[model samples]
Target: MAESLGSNEVTFRLSRCRQSVPRSRAALHAVLGGWGVDQDVLESAELMLSELVTNALRVRVPNDRQVGVRIARLLEDGLLRLEVSDAGSGRPEVRAPGDDETGGRGLLLVEALAHRWGVEKRAGGIGKTVWAELKAPDIVAEPVGREVAAVMVRPGQQVRAWGKWRAVRTVRTESYAAGGLAIVLGLGEGPALRVHAAEPLTVRDDSVPSARERGEGTPG
Candidate 1:
């Protein structure tokens, strides 16, 4: 049985390191529902946990040993924490991989999405614990957080602001199709309007047109 920390916190220890990533992620989504974490956070957390736990297993522990994942919600404080620990001694360092390098971007992604992240010295100096945290969405903020809202734009949709921080913004795309475009907000640096893979598109700028336009779209 997994250990429970108060009503909101859950810690699971797995003897089989292989199960650490998937189990921790599922536990987060399953248990932390009412806390109002966004899907992007959840997905990023999953990938982060996978990388962290995998590093602990492959780099630190012997093949036979295991790792632990702790998921806790500080309800009053509005913080969600994920901790992954293994019985290995060395701490992880973030390295900038070369352009041709294939695999070392895990911690990079974690650093980008997580509001804060760090590693701590475990008791007895035997090993270390890596943790990442995300702040719960402030519902009272000015920008009304909504699910994907799709809008079509004519040629002149003004590009006043173009990023994720804004409550409202504008996006444009090359072609149209039925259910062809979904304006995915809260994506990395900006709101994204995603056209389904099958749609035809023409490119003018170095970057793709923001598929999901958040601002008012004038009729063509």
Candidate 2:
């Protein structure tokens, strides 16, 4: 059973599976609809929820993993926030899309439709939560004229096969970059993926490469 944390937030604690995703997605749609979100925004919100929830379930550890999604509104700014989280160490990456790929296109749609999107470490550093924000169309006193551009990203795969007599063939290709770079790497492989930068990405007295890029640190 799921718990309601008040403040208009609904939490569903369920396993990662094909069946659970649609149900969760539907629930989000209903809840957002009740909030008077327009049809277009409602569809986009549903897509974002579906993609994130699906990712959480797909990449979670196989040992009875529990995934959760939270939807709430910012009372101050009247913005809706959508969060999908899992109790796994895997992070999320964003990248450009490649041709000849199936699936992994959901996140690209989310990034395009959402007003702003980012990832942050879950409370207590046990997991990560990917979130997105959308402006309430009904209540826009002073609209920002700036539009965020969406990137095309998808997922590809490597195929290995044996042909005719006995020769073996292999092909390596991108699986997905939906939403940007949707690949996350943990600290388990040799020469762990790291990005070095000569300058800081921001003026906050820091000198680390941006985290949204591929094969960087954990999301957040």
Candidate 3:
């Protein structure tokens, strides 16, 4: 079970298995939910933590040792600090992942999501700690604008943009600044657009695209 260490800190001791990722996310959901965190920030934090904890659990640890997950909510600073520690020796870093890579693309995701992040040695000299900070008051994505710039749209799908429904020409994840997915709309003829995926939109029957967009993060 997760425990609240104080007014703004929470910690969880995770088992040595793949299930720990979602389990830890549930723990964070519970703690952050109670603290009135913004829905967007909460979800982004969960995604980032999923990546960090998954990275932490990947490295080999000592016999019977488990990963350590800690969260510190700096409300005054408007930042939520998260740390994942393991007894492994390797450190986490960001690098361009190959197109055929199946996994191990988490560092890139972290660089795109968190406000800032880095690695440091643990206190007991056993292993290193990978940490990230997420800013609060996350942008609540609302339907506040139509005719968004052709570049700030999802690719490979039809969207209500550019003053009409258009199919996205080409799309790729992690192609935008700040870690959201990017797609080239106007059937690959126009400039790239910035986009974040929001809730599943309810489009009328005639408005739906043949192939809808999908990804780990969001579309514009």
Candidate 4:
């Protein structure tokens, strides 16, 4: 089961097994993706999350004690935080493994990819939580103010259809005879709509400029 800790945070528990690694990664992707996280930062966060969950599974914890995972987006700091808690003793450290070794490089990769990372003792001292933070890019808000061709509509934007504005969930292109092309917009709550390249569609616009567009750097 998953729980929403806050508007910007989510927490979930996973069984202490290999499958939890991918499950945690997917969960992070969904959360971050929904938050409009940049593609590069999203991928890095997924990798770090996978490593953390895998390490948590390695610890000798009771079978009934599931691993805890928490993901949060720090808006003030523009950072993505990933935490994996296991009910086992000992802190994990970066290791320099020989090239011939099959494993033992998880923390090493985490250190290289993450902006910063460390281990923390869980509340009540039952186990430790491995945490990492990465510099997250500013979310790209959907553009507005002008109607564009149907082919120009991108996923995550809202389009007018069926007497109401619906969120565009996906965009696909289809080719027809004599090199004719059509754009297919899949709505979040209804059937897909097809339109020509020159069809005009309204989308939600960004009323405020983003930090990057304003020449501001990401927060530390």
**Clashing residue pairs in candidate 1 (N, C-alpha, C atoms within 3 angstroms):** 171-213, 193-211, 193-212
Which stretch of 10 consecutive residues in model 2 shows the poorest summed lDDT?
Answer: 158-167
User: Cα lDDT of all candidates, in order?
Assistant: 0.58, 0.57, 0.69, 0.81
Q: Write the per-residue lDDT of candidate 4 for residues 90-184, one digit (tens) a residue.
A: 87878999989999989999999999999989976599999999987575333344578888888877787875567788899998666778899
Alpha carbon RMSD to native, model 1? 14.9
Clashes of each: 3, 14, 11, 2
Colliding pairs, model 4: 143-205, 144-205
- The alpha-carbon lDDT assigned to residue 130 of candidate 2 equals 89
lDDT of 4: 0.81
Off by over 4 Å in 3: 138-220
Comparing 3 and 4 by lDDT, which wins?
4
Over 4 Å off in model 1, which ranges? 34-36, 138-220
Error of 3 at 165 (Å): 46
Ranking by TM-score: 4, 3, 2, 1
Ten-residue segment with the worst summed lDDT in candidate 3?
A: 207-216
lDDT of 4 at 205: 39
TM-score of 4: 0.67
Model 3, span 21-107: residue lDDT tens: 999998888877655566677888999999999988788776478888998888567788889988888777787878897887898
For all predicted structures, in order, the TM-scores are: 0.56, 0.58, 0.61, 0.67
